[model samples]
Target: MTYTVNCSILLTELPLLERPAAAKAAGFDAVEFWWPFTASVPADAELTRFEQAITDAGVQLTGLNFNAGDMPGGDRGLVSWMGRSSEFKDNIDVVAGIGGRLGCRSFNALYGNRQDGQTPEAQDELAVQNLAAAAEGVARIGGTVLLEPVSGAPRYPLLTAEDAVRVISRVKEQTGAANIKLLADFYHLSVNGDDVAAVIEKHAKDFGHIQIADNPGRGAPGTGELPLGEWIARSRQLGYEGHIGLEYKAPAETAFAWAIRQRIAQ
Candidate 1:
């Protein structure tokens, strides 16, 4: 299994476009993004700059994220995808085109919000529907969309491993795209009361990628009580080979960098 670090870990020092260089310097095989293209919305020039950074670093471009819609628009992103009446599918197209140009093969997206007055059953149906749209976009470019569950978005339908797999399976069955899959994020899973390795093993096939940080603190692995090393070993034992994304805040760059190297070596 290869370990990848999210440039968000050092967002301040690493320019948005230069994140790949920084990640490679720190010994990561690849890098993940959280809406970095969002640094310049719909701007082709800025996206091009990002493309060059990855090339300069010689690091594999692992994943890019779709827009986080629950922000200013209060669920406009997920709602757009959910309702199927809007242009949510079109939004994913932007990610596919941009990520493809950047040599990235994967993208992450969310179900979004728990808006007031929206019933759980209704939101679930919407989530399944939107997944089909995402699948369509991925199919066009031979790419993938990793659907993630978040504890923060309680109103959203996908908030657990089981929920994510069931919905993802339904979408795959319908679209036969083979690209739509689950994103097993440890921070979110810990927040939602699930064992990290256990859930990961059960859903390994559906796992598009993996993200890690210690529980409670969500800091770098060695900083907290999470037995990250043991779990990583278990993942390897289970025959799982994919990117392990470090999406935590490090206490200090120099110290965190050292610890990360040690963890990966283990």
Candidate 2:
């Protein structure tokens, strides 16, 4: 199986700019990240340095997230936030510029937590608009906008494949854009109680990208109860051809030990 290191989650031991080289040293040919900036539009120099790090490391930037606000502070995303639509829209160009430069064609747009002041109908409507705009922005580079079903954020509405696909279908139907797709994350799907095997069987061909982490603890494969290897194999059998993103939490020193074990097992 081809794997891409999710530098944002895996290489926290190093400074952000240094993670690309670390991933390269760790034997990964590609890397992915959440938005690696405090603001939607960072300064030019920050962008330059970020691009240079990936370039110098000789690794492909395969996936990136649109600016999801204050991730650690519990801001899941801005897409459905009642008053933050502009912030989400403004982020599209920055994302496109970085992805365009780094050869990243897949962008994850986290649907924000539901706001107390707004109706679900209102938020869903805004999300379709913003996602459609995002799809259009990245289409210049033949990019695909990815909608993921995330776990752990209680207010995050998309916690099942059906939920995310509903939104994806809405974006395509409303905007006539075919570049939007689902990011089937095995860990999140399992945590949310989705039928993982059924998801892969029915929707693997629809995935724009796939990410993995063992469930229960979100650790490296074999450290948790989830049968990630079996699920991944099934996904491949169903024709999902994207690199599997390693987006689990573990000490950087021992993160890839499971990969070694998997190789030996094979």
Best by TM-score: 2
The global Cα lDDT (0 to 1) of model 1 is 0.69
Q: Give the alpha carbon lDDT tens digit for every residue of 1-266 in model 1.
A: 47776875555465677667767776676888776644324677766777777888888878877776534344524632434435556567777887677667778877676556667667666766676777777767778888787665545556688877787777667666567778888788878887777885776655778788877777777777777777667766776677888788764366256555777888
Candidate 1: residue 47 lDDT (0-100):
65
TM accuracy, model 2: 0.98
Consecutive 10-residue window with the lowest summed lDDT within model 1: 76-85
State the C-alpha lDDT per candidate. Answer: 0.69, 0.93
Q: Clashing residue pairs, candidate 1?
A: 114-155
**Model 2 Cα lDDT, one tens digit per residue, 93-166:** 99999998989999999999999979999999999999999999999999999999999999999999999999
Q: Which stretches of candidate 2 lie over 4 Å from their true place?
A: 264-266
